[model samples]
Target: MSPTPEAVDLSQQRALADWLPGRLAAEQPAILVLGDVMLDGWWSGSIERLCREAPAPVVDVQNRESVPGGAANTAMNLAALGARVSVAGIIGTDDAGMDLRNQLVAAGIDVTYLLDHPDMVTTTKIRISSGGQVMLRIDDSARSVPAEALAELAASVRSAVEHQHAVMVCDYGTGVLADPVRRGLVDALAGRDRAEPGVRPLLVVDSHDPRPWAPLRPDLVTPNAQETARMLDLRLPEGQERVAEVSRHADALLEATGAGAVVVTLDRDGTVLLRPDGVTHRTWARPAAEKQASGAGDTFVAALTLARSAGLPLTASLDLAQAAADVVVHQPGTSVCSTAQLSRYLKAFADTALEAGELERQLELHRAQDQRIVLTNGCFDVLHSGHTRYLNQAKQLGDILVVALNSDESVRRLKGAGRPINAVADRAAVVAALSCVDYVTVFDTPTAAPLIRQLRPEVYAKGGDYTPEMLAETPAVEEYGGRVAILDYVADRSTTAVVNKIRDGEGAVQTN
Candidate 1:
């Protein structure tokens, strides 16, 4: 039987967690971010009284911070994800522009193509908040870019696209990506050599109105529900209804945006990818706070673009992008997901204990990727340094490590009454929390022979110094051309010894 959607999602998430760190480390793809660039300002303070001038709360501004917004925010996120990023946009020669430029430079983004227009006012949005509630927002982006600035920006776009692996267009209905600029982008995309398969640079559009750039034939276009509604000129319902509506019009959206795929982001409901092949891939959103910072969509686009440029599958790239968006939604203000932060967030998926069926399905995926799987089983009643060392050693024997735990009933039957001071759930959670263990599952069987035979991992590891003939599971392993490995055992580190010592009150207990 085919795996369920939930099972597939779990398997994909696990694979991404294991694959991202290495993939990000090996390649630093160059990406060019083009479109409207703005400065986001946050002014937060305490509010104790109403303003005398108007019916509004008075905010005693205590702290003020500024960060990049719009297309520049996308560039910041790309840089944080370890991409060699360059930004092409028009910004006024004002203080906000200078601050945005300095921040982008400090973040290691190439700003050579950031054109400075003397007459235009740099786009800046400042939010005033007190006690976690936004009081008012002030915008300073009224002037339009002159013809001279637009010409310069168009030239810069043409030049920047030559060396980039991907171009991410972030259009907020701003004048920076004017007709001239878009023509330059389209001409540059058309001029690229396509003699070799997969040689053309990817074009990803994250615009409020994507129809204008349809001529460029973007590889991907990300539109939220509102933007999708605008494109279709139909008011969408809430929740799953909206998703269904978008799916029904997938062909129209594809044709309208001229994109190979369209990813419609449904906010808390997560995102869905629609393709011309009539295949739709959906990623459910992980748990996140209701109140999130701005620029999460920018983070998603940055990650999606980077992943695609790195040659990841479309579905996998969407999953990674959703993961990145999930990470930044929990922070305050405009935030970016760094490589280390994204890696850690992905690794957190390993903490979930899977059922035997799900575990087997996930193992199949790992095996198909040519990753050797190592299986080990034990009570793991009380996790300690000894158990950690053993698991680490087992992980070194293979590319993926699977730890099986004895259920409560099985633990009691094997170790007698008062055994397993910790329950099976607790045991599995603790073992899965270890970095060395990739997957954890519970079994009620008296022996692990059945699981070993079912999984047929490349190696079956045991911590004790026992010969293969002494183990019941050894035969099961050998029957399938799998080897049995014995890991190093730490003496005097048994769980029984620790429990006995605690019962005897022999050691000083530490308190938090």
Candidate 2:
């Protein structure tokens, strides 16, 4: 067997972050979710003391909330991430079923395929929490899907998956994904793929049991460690060997199931995605001291499917999915990650640093929205009022301000040794955090001419009382119909003067 490959070190997060907004704006990809749908109810109250009857604490219920769970939860996540999602599954003709449908509809999911069964009871997991801690979980579920109901659901699944960009099989072992229904879904997807060739919708499976799904030949299957181990009939690996062990087990899963890829989620350790070509991509989990890992897996698979449907590569999709899971695990209850939350989350990680290509991708999207770009360059070694005012002026010139800083080597060559008080990463972060600056990137050149050539901004901005004739990038700026704006210099604010003053003990150099 081939050794597990290292995770793809591509800037997938940055790429996905740059790609998402435009994809979301251009089109809302449709996804069909099939399997067991459930309602998750939360009852919360304050627990003051132990109950007088049993050992359990007495809880006075003050608030009651219900949300979609199981396959429905997956659909909710896809919808929350801006996918045009539709749900196809069996639900009881009860209050929980009605509530589940309402919640799905409220989240902008199509419930046309959500069939109601008179004999079945809507699956529900009611969690009671006291003082922010879950005290008890009461599960109300029906294990059997009537044959007629299953046939109806299979028909619904077939029709729903036809027009969707992707299909998600979210099986919780709830009998909704029984053998017959699974085979029907598989046949339906196969027919569609055969009919459309390269245009067929991608199929992703996240099942409690991986065996039944294996024959479906899903494009991707997300299995937790135990599920993957169970499918392979192997024990979970322990300690330092976990990564390698999981990779090996994922290999077995792929061979056994014939899945195009297998994503083994190793709880807090992170996730490993194994492709058929013997490539394994790993992503480390985002850190959190306290975790609410209840709905993290659903969040992950949903984002993964959505990103893949949006045409991002598997690496970018995995990055976006991992980031989405990280966001959900830090929140309470079985919650879905919203698009705004995801956008903010990606921004937090990508803001500190970005490559020029990623920045250009972002710029393209911004321009698509008619947002004019403003480009500026500087060492920004030690931020001061001069830099702040300069960046502020640049921001006024366009809808977005992009600051491209020189690399350490470039800075050293231009300003001599020991000139940049802060490293490039640190400087980029500092500039990125400023309110006036919209994006930050680093260029390994003595001048920003190359970056200017790539960006071709509507306005090229400069500060510190420099005339256009003195700037070498003037022709490059004018080449793209970009006008140069030179802002007034802030008196007594030069970094050199500040360093000289501090060197001579005239005063302390203030950093802004």
Give me the runs in candidate 1 sitting further than 4 Å from their true place.
1-15, 194-198, 354-512
lDDT of 2 at 13: 23
- Candidate 1 lDDT over residue span 437-501, tens digit each: 67898888879999888889999999976888899888899998999998876676777665665
Span of ten consecutive residues with least summed lDDT in model 1: 1-10
Model 2, residue 385: C-alpha shift (Å): 39
Residues 1-512 of candidate 2 have per-residue lDDT tens digits of 11111111112223334445445534578999988899998899998888878887898999998888889889888888888998888899999999988888888888999999899899999999877788889999886778889888776666777878888988888798887788788778878878888877888988887767777778888888888778777787674357688776655788776789888888676677787776556555664666434788899899899878876667546756877888898888789898888767655634466788888999999999998999999888765556665675677677778888888888889889767766776667556644456788888876888889998899999997799989999999988788988887777788767555545656544432
Note the residue pairs that clash in candidate 2: none
Please report, in order, the local distance difference test score of every candidate based on alpha carbons: 0.81, 0.77
* Residue pairs with backbone atoms closer than 3 Å in model 1 (clashes): none
Clashes of 2: 0
Best by TM-score: 1
TM-score attained by model 1: 0.69
**Distance from true location, Cα of 439 in model 2, Å:** 18
